[model samples]
Target: MTCRVLLADDHAVIRAGVRAMIQDIDDFTIVGEAEDGKETVEMARELEPDIILLDISMKKVSGLEALQALNRHSPECKVLILSMHTGPEVVLEALQKGAHGYLLKDAAAFELRLALEAVRRGDRYLSSAIVQPVIEQAVSKVNSNAEHTLTQRQLEILRLITRGESTRSIANGLGLSVKTVEAHRAQIMKRLQIHDVPGLVLYAVREGIISPDD
Candidate 1:
């Protein structure tokens, strides 16, 4: 059976290249293409594609956020992240957040094919190059003196708050009550040992959760 795919990439050239590479494959069909994360989610919801190829970088919402949304809204649809970022943390975080596969952008198309096929079968797929590093990073975290802990919801709250979003804005964005948003913000600061808004933003930036320009 062929897998229907929703292709998402910010760059028109990259999207075209992907279409050219995979359109001829007997088992893959291009059901839709999206240029940004919002469009990606819309296509996923509208087309109900079997798999979505998500690019990490995009204009509005990042692919990571879109993956989280898809996982929550369309649990059956598999998400495969194709990114240029090779950070072990990014790969591990994406996998943990429900991405079925993580393949670097530089990987061969054969590897892309393999990843999609593997994830289609309900198995997780990580590129061979980053597999060891991801594993080691996980192991090191377990063996470290630092305690790493945060729920997915908590991480989402942290991201928004650090970006200087007001509580009401965050509540509206995440569909939560303002009070609940404030509670999450408090919990985040307490956990991170940050008492100041500026400190929270700085921590978010240092942790790669947000950029300085964000």
Candidate 2:
């Protein structure tokens, strides 16, 4: 069955473009649409799509806020942040707040489909093109001992692994080597001083990353 999808964006043209691209994918179908975060949340509740694609700077509530609300009301519904922001901090913040995936607004249609599928399968999806810088940022944060020491890529990989993706699967999905993914995992665990999977999950939850509600 095709994965039911909801699109929430302030721009009609962008939404139209995304819909046009998604139409080419056989495994996805747009079941609902909303123009802003508030409406996005409402339609999401009513439509109950398997995934929700949101734009961050909506007119009413921001996508970040909408993501949190959707996760709260319908934890089964996954959220993908498809915004123009490419900064490491912005992506990490969105993921930390409750987004299941992140992608650039200019990303290709196939990438959008991939993001939706990954998130729907209880995994995470981030634009692979952006993962390296995100990882570097995370490592820096960890070294700095910041309040939430995570980069967007590390958070993405961590969420995917915690959601049950294997090292090879994560590498394939993110376009990285299995060794590289394992290295990142080891580094994350070491920096956080987490010994195992349960500890990792607890740390993620405690730090406001992915939630059990997610």
Candidate 2 off by > 4 Å: 143-214
What lDDT would each prediction earn against the true structure? 0.79, 0.80
User: In model 2, how large is the Cα lDDT of residue 129?
Assistant: 71
Question: Model 2, residue 24: displacement in angstroms?
Answer: 1.1
The digit string of per-residue lDDT tens for model 2 on 1-214 reads 8889999999999999999998998888999889998999899889999888889999979888898888799788888899998898887778777787789988887787778777777666778776655555654555334354767889999888766586888999999998999889998888877655544655665566765544
In TM-score terms, which candidate is top? Answer: 2
TM-score of each: 0.66, 0.70
Worst 10 residues of 2 by lDDT: 139-148
- State how far residue 58 of model 2 sits from its true place (Å): 0.7
